[model samples]
Target: MSPEAIRKFWSLIEETQTNILLTLDNDALVIWLSRQLRREEFLKRVDTRDLNAYISERLPLIRDLAQERLAYQSHSSG
Candidate 1:
């Protein structure tokens, strides 16, 4: 897709994520998980935590979003 379209897609997701974060009362588990993702210090805070598993669980939405964006671009480009 064109650069503008790509930017717009990112913008939409950023806006969506932002709105979701703002409107929903994120539970404690989600907050902790998000912190685990964001904080380097927290990575070591808890022993016996499987960070990879956490990463794996969180990766699909990112992959799906990218795949969906690519498919949409392909359809529009053809």
Candidate 2:
């Protein structure tokens, strides 16, 4: 992807993360942060060969979803 496309992709990810956070309470955030802390350690101790395969599969689904969303927006606007 070009730099602009990569930046846009990350912007989308950040937007989704922000929306998710808007729905979460502070207590829930603390709990989620605790889990994430554990996951950092867990990752260092585990094998991750399946991670790449899973991402390869999910990436196409994400791409198709974005395409469908764009099409819907275009159709609605027109």
Candidate 3:
């Protein structure tokens, strides 16, 4: 993925993390991420198949990162 796409991916992850109600199962999360990625202007030229594949592959890592982020935030705040 390009730098812009990577940035946008993290941004969306953070956004999702912030919105607790947006928590979704693995399959639904992948679909939601793919849809969000497609809506990005910077990612418009990228193939949908590639984007979906990329997100699917990284979903576990993404969840880990988001969980870590939340833990750190809660720890720091508390």
| Candidate 2 lDDT tens digits, 1-78 | 334433443454334444343344544543443344334443333334343333344454544555666677679999
Candidate 3 per-residue C-alpha lDDT over 1-78 given as tens digits, one digit per residue, 9 for 90 to 100: 888898888788777754441378777877778888888887888888888888888877887787787788899999
Which tens-of-lDDT digit does each residue in 1-78 have in candidate 1?
A: 334433543454443433343343335334534454434443444332454344335444544664566677679999
Indicate the residue-level lDDT of 62 in model 2.
Answer: 46
Choose the strongest candidate by lDDT.
3
Per-residue lDDT, model 1, residue 36, is 40
* Model 1, C-alpha of 39: deviation from truth (Å): 13
Q: In model 1, which regions exceed 4 Å deviation?
A: 1-56
Per-candidate local distance difference test: 0.45, 0.44, 0.78
Q: Against the true structure, what is each candidate's TM-score?
A: 0.31, 0.35, 0.75
Sort by TM-score, best first: 3, 2, 1
Model 2, residue 50: what's the lDDT?
42
TM-score of 2: 0.35
